[model samples]
Target chain A: GAGVSQSPSNKVTEKGKDVELRCDPISGHTALYWYRQSLGQGLEFLIYFQGNSAPDKSGLPSDRFSAERTGGSVSTLTIQRTQQEDSAVYLCASSWGRPGSPLHFGNGTRLTVT
Target chain B: GESVGLHLPTLSVQEGDNSIINCAYSNSASDYFIWYKQESGKGPQFIIDIRSNMDKRQGQRVTVLLNKTVKHLSLQIAATQPGDSAVYFCAENSGSNYKLTFGKGTLLTVNP
Candidate 1:
């Protein structure tokens, strides 16, 4: 795809279950980011990955959340023991690793914990 | 302790009128700023950006202004149309910071 792609447009799971969301960045984008957006709120940065550098987890809200990028191409975000508060849209974005380059984002995956 | 905030939560403008959205950042070190437009059920779309070095940057039908002294940022949309209605967000990044801090957002409603 010409832009970033995310899988499982919507997902529903039990409160104690685990779920994984996928993101496929643009062909040559070297920077990837994960963000969470709750209803009527702005985006909250979750994690970032650039090249082979270690992913920045500074924004992850809790230990139950984790993410990884394989070969620096595709990335996955996993949420363990999903709580009702975990319900939100998970957005993925990619950029060219420039200081001020714009990020292209995917539609996002809407997660609902029952 | 860094945060970005919007001056207004919602704004309604008539078609053909110019619209302005404002943001304030608490991080004095922030050097880069961006404006994004998000439609319902879609991710944010980049609109325009301005760096601290320059006070203003312009794009198609849109302009971004930065005020470092007051830590204020504003996005202007010229000749607003109904299609321009969306939630607008302002984001900031400091030197060597890859992650962006976003403002709560302002919903713009362009009425015909």
Candidate 2:
């Protein structure tokens, strides 16, 4: 794709249900990132992947949050036993995996946990 | 933990006027800074960026100024337009970190 692509532009689920959000990064981009934006709040970093290196999961809010990147390309974020507080916009971004590379973002998936 | 923060929560500017948004970062090691504009229901769009080595950088109608001494960053929009009404965020990244730490953001409203 010419730009980063995210699946299921919007998702709504009952509390305690699990949800999986997918992201397709731009071709040739070796760095991928996931962030959460609460209503009217700043972006909170969730995870980052650089090539085949170990992903930085330090920013994950809890054990219920986890992400994986396959082939250094597409990525998926899974939220287990979702809570109402999980309601927010999930944003995916990709970069060149080099210093000073600007990130290209996807439209994002708005997850509403009722 | 180190973080980026905005000095103002919101600003209202008249159309055709100049708009400035400010940010402060806590980390002195941060080497790269970026500004992003996000509209309602949309992802953040890259505005411009500046490196710690340079004091300023300019884009189409936007300019980014970095003051490493005070760890402050600002974005200036020339001739603000109604379409420029959006939330602006400042992000910082260091050489050792791959993730960009974002600021709370400043809502800029261009009033006609």
Candidate 3:
């Protein structure tokens, strides 16, 4: 892909339901990241994947939030038993390298938990 | 739980005027900072970045100033336009992993 691509542009789900958001990073990029932004808020880092190594899960808010990157190419963020507070825009980004390289972002999936 | 935070929630500027958004981060270890512009319903777009070693960096119509002494960062936009109206965010890279810690964004509106 020319840029980061996220699936299911918008999702409205009931509280307690589970939801999955997918992200396909730009081709040849080695680093991928996930972030969440609530209404009128800043981006909250969630997770980061670098190659096949273990992900940096430091930013996941709680046990209900989890993510996995398969084959070092695509990634999925899963939220279990979603709550109303879970409503937010989920964004994904990718960079060709690390630290010094700038990231390219996806349009993001807006998840609404009612 | 500490992170960067914005000093202003919103700023209104006349078209063609200059705009400045400020951020304060808590971590002294943070080595990298980036500024981003996000429009409605869209993801954030990178504006410019500055490392801890440098006090300033410039990009097209944009400048990032980092004041490590005060743990503050600011983004200055030159010749603001209505199309430049959006939320601006500042993010810090605090660790070797380079995960970002973002501040509450500042909404900039260029009134024409």
Candidate 4:
């Protein structure tokens, strides 16, 4: 793809339901990241993957939130038993895994839990 | 627990005037900084970036200034236009970690 691509631009799920968001990073980019932006809030780091190294999951908010990058390209974020507080925009970005590389962000998936 | 913060939550400037947005970070280890502009219903777009080795960087009509002494970063927009009205965020990276810590953001409104 020309840029980071995300699926389901918007989602509305009931509380306690599970939701899955997907991201397809640019070709050849080995670094991918996930972030969450609450209404009127800053971007919160969730996780990151660099090449084949172990993913840095230190930023994941809770046990209910998890993500995985397959084949070093596409990634998916899964939220189990979602809560109303989880309503926010989930953003995905990718980089070349090189020094001074800038992150290219996707439009994001706006999730609304009712 | 290092964090990035902004001095002002909102800034209103007249069109054609210069606008300045400020950000402060707690981590001295951070070596790279970037400014992003986000419009309503859209994702943040990179504006400009500066490395710790330099105090300033310029791009198009925007300039980013880094003051390592005070752990402060600022973005200045020349001749602010209506299209420039958006929320600005500053992100800092520690080079080694490759993770970016973003500030809350400052809403810049350009009044015509």
Candidate 5:
């Protein structure tokens, strides 16, 4: 694809439900990342992946949040036991995984936990 | 614990006029800086980037200036247009750490 793509532009789930968001990065991009944005808030880093190395999970807000990148391409972010506070936009981005490579972002998925 | 932040939360400007957004960072070790613009209902798009080794970089109508001594970074938009209205964010990267540290964004509004 010409740009990063995310699935299910919007999702509304009841509190305590689980939600899965998917991302397909640009072709050949070796690095992928996930970020969250609350209403009127800045982007908060969640997780990062480069090649087959273990993802950098330092930014995950809680144990309920986890992500997996398959075959160095598509990625999924799963939020378990979603809380009302989880209502926000989930953004995905990809890069060349090299020095000076800028990240290309997708439109993002807006998750509303009611 | 954000290491980067903007001085203004919102900036208003007339279309065709120049606009400048300012940001400050606390990490002296940060070696790379980038500016991104995000429109409503969309993700952030990279504008321009500047390495710590240099003080300035220009791209089309945008220019990024970095003052590592003061840990300050600013983006200057030339002949700003209504389409340029969006939230601007500054991100920093230090050395081999590929993870970027982003600052709270500044909303830029261009009035026609």
Candidate 6:
């Protein structure tokens, strides 16, 4: 694909339900990132992947939030027991992670936990 | 509790006028800075980036200036247009790492 792609542009789920968001990064991009944006808020880093290495999960807001990148390409963010506060736009970005490489972003998945 | 913040929440400008959005970062170890523009219901798009080694960088109609001395970064848009209305965010990368810390963002409304 020419750009990073995310699945299910919008998702409406009841509170306490589990939601899975998928992201397909640009081909040949070795680094992928997950971020969350609350209403009128900035992008909050959630996780980062470098090839097949263990992801940097320090940014996950809670234990309920987890993500995995497979084959250094596609990635999934799983939010368990989603709370109302979990409602937000989940964005995915990919970059080469080389010197001076900028991140390319996907349209994002808007999750509404009612 | 470290984060980047913007000095202004919203900026309104007339078409063709120049616009400036300012940001302040708390992390002194941040070495790389990037500016992004996001439209309604869309993801952020990279605008310009500047490394700690340099104080300024220019791209298209946007110029990003970094003042590491005061931990301040600013994006200046020349001849702003109605199409330029969007939210702008500044992100900082930790020294020698690409982990980005983003600012709250400033809404730029260019009135035609």
Deviation of model 1 at A12, angstroms: 1.0
Candidate 2 C-alpha lDDT tens digits along B1-112:
7899999999999999999999999999999999999999999998898889999998999989998889899999999999999999999999888789999899999999
TM-score of 4: 0.96
Give candidate 4 misplaced runs (Cα > 4 Å).
A52-54
Model 6 segments more than 4 A misplaced: none
Runs of candidate 1 with Cα error greater than 4 angstroms are none
CA-lDDT, candidates in order: 0.92, 0.93, 0.89, 0.92, 0.91, 0.91
- TM-score for candidate 3: 0.93
Q: Which ten residues in a row are the worst by lDDT in model 1 chain A? A: A50-59
Candidate 4 pairs with clashing backbones: none
Alpha-carbon RMSD, candidate 4: 1.3
lDDT string, candidate 4, B12-109, tens digits:
99999999999999999989999999999888888999999999999999999999999999999999999999999999888787888899999999
- DockQ-best of 4 and 6: 4
lDDT of 1 by residue, A53-108 (tens): 64588889999999999998999999999999999999999999777777888999
Model 2 has an lDDT value of 0.93
Q: Model 5 TM-score?
A: 0.97
For residues A1-114, what per-residue lDDT tens digits would candidate 5 score against the true structure?
A: 389999989999999999999999999989999999887788888989996554589989899998888898999999999999999999999999876678888999999999
- Measured against the true two-chain complex, the DockQ scores of the candidates, in the order shown, are 0.73, 0.76, 0.63, 0.70, 0.71, 0.65
TM-score of each: 0.96, 0.97, 0.93, 0.96, 0.97, 0.95
Per-residue lDDT over A1-114 for candidate 3, one digit per residue giving the tens place of the 0 to 100 score:
387899999999999999999999998888899999999888888888897454688889999998888888999999999999999999999886577667789999999999
Local error of candidate 6 at A85, Å?
1.2
lDDT at position A53, candidate 1: 62
Q: List the residue pairs that clash in candidate 1.
A: none
Please state the error at residue A94 of candidate 1 in Å. 0.9
The ten-residue window of minimal lDDT in model 4 chain B covers: B92-101
Off by over 4 Å in 2: none
Clashing pairs in 3: none
Name the weakest run of 10 consecutive residues (lDDT summed) in model 4 chain A: A50-59
